[model samples]
Target: MLESLTPFETVLVAGASRGVGREIARILQPNFTVKALLRSNIAVNELEVLGIQPIMGDAMIPEQLDLSGIDAVISTIGGLPGDIKRADDEGNRNLIDAARKAGVKKFVLVTSIGCGDSVVALPPRALEALGAVLEDKEKAEQHLIDSGLTYTIVRPGGLKSEPATGTGFLTEDPKISGSIHRADVADLVCKCLISDRANQKILSALDRNQMFSASEIVEFIP
Candidate 1:
């Protein structure tokens, strides 16, 4: 027998204007009503086509979020160049405070693999080029862990736009690395929202030699 932790309901998808965030909202539409938060009108048009309610809120400005009736939140927001910490760390704090005020609890944060190490996993040149975005992401992850909210952190390896591989893996340790299709990462995130088993776990998502259904993925929660 299967028991669900919470009813599938409205979700707020930060950064949903593009990439994994957008796809995640699309895939979850049938089962969950999504509020797609983005900073621009261009993104609003794309989400509106998919029947998503577009909310104009930059992760950098969390007070702008209208989180009423939001059952859960999935944030794929990232920062680059001179804006990583401002975007990820400060932005996340703002978002979390807003969610807390709204009485929303469940959260799934999309972060990167190898963000917390003394040395970033990516090549120094790549880090420099991105201006150390991972450092900001790492700080955001720690903030969530310390936020006293029910949370799950997903640290994924290189992100690609390929179709879901239909097979994926997770690790407690962050040493493993591989690329993952954006769709699979999205699916994993939605699954976490409804999974009681996933609470308070930090799981690394990667493409590996394993086959599992979305339900099976919940077992990876530690």
Candidate 2:
């Protein structure tokens, strides 16, 4: 049977406006005091309705992060296309520096599977498609890994907007990769935060059923 460790009192979800970050805040709401780090006032009302405290801040600006008194930080921030300066690379580094200063217990980073030495996890075409964006994510991953903070780096395979399948799994094998729902990633992030086993581990998140299959895994994600 699955179990949960003692939950942290306060947790911050950077990039909480949408995508994976929004889901992380939603999953952490039941037991933890969830804080949503948003860039503008656009998401404030929605986050408030979800029972999350919205903090107006931008991850791109490192100095804006007032991480004082926060227990943990889950960063799901990524860059948009065609931007010479990428948020995935520098934005995350800023968060790490701030987290280190605040003495946060755990910094959970949600990156993609092909980051760093895990390039084996993706096909050549995918890498070609991502290009510099993937490179930026790799740099961010390395920055977090080298920050000396207790961190769990989660590299998910292709992310789907589907609901939680409850079948997501984590593995150290970089060669293993596939598609997984964003909600499932949020579920695993919640689990990883409270589990001592996940500390300092660089894990790949994927649906177990899609782990191996040449024909299927290639076109697994849209």
Candidate 3:
């Protein structure tokens, strides 16, 4: 279990219309003032129903993202198969720039396991299939690292939509590879948001029982 510290009162979440970003906004809604940056009006009603304020904007357009009043920021934005502009790098780059200009306290970016030093953990076939996307995510990761903001980069392994297994955890070991539920990734991201120890860290998230190898694991507790 992770200990909670002085939590940020207001948070802005990018990519909150769906996936892990949506889950993170859901988790933070009850305790904090949560805002989601959205490119469309489609999810506005749905997010408003959950007590999350939806800001109509696109992360890819720097002028559209205004983070002035946000205390913290979390981005799980990515690209689609036929997208003309990938959000994995360009979108995140704009967000990082906005966060820096807004002086946001912390930024939590959700990427994939094959990003950065974790590439060795993936099978060659998987790497071949996802090489382009991983390269883009790595670019986003590096952008955040170089942005001079307190940041936590979480590279989750293969993602599942099932309920959290509770066994999901994080490790600094980039060689670790496994599958984890999206809810579990949301949980870890929330924990890292308030954890000073997670600042400036790049960690991999996985389920203990779903690892691809039997290597010894040292879980990172924050």
Candidates in order have lDDT scores of 0.74, 0.84, 0.92
Regions of model 3 farther than 4 Å from truth? 1-7
Model 1 sits at a Cα RMSD from the real structure of 4.7
Clashing pairs in 2: none
Put down candidate 3 lDDT per residue, 1-222, tens digits, no spaces.
Answer: 333346588999999999899999999888889999999999999999999999888888888988989899999999864577899999999999999999899999999999988999999999988888999999999999999999999999999999989999999999989899999999999999988999999999999999888989999997
For candidate 2, the lDDT comes to 0.84
lDDT of 1 at 157: 72
Top model number, TM-score: 3
Among all windows of ten consecutive residues in candidate 1, which has the lowest summed lDDT? 210-219
Scanning candidate 2 in windows of ten residues, the lowest lDDT window is 213-222
- Report lDDT (Cα) of residue 139, candidate 1: 82
| Best model per lDDT | 3
What TM value does model 3 have? Answer: 0.96
TM-scores of all candidate predictions against the true structure: 0.84, 0.91, 0.96
For candidate 3, list the clashing residue pairs, or say none: none
For candidate 1, lDDT tens digit of each residue in 131-221? 4677678888888888788888888777889889866566665445567888888877777777777888888887764322222233374
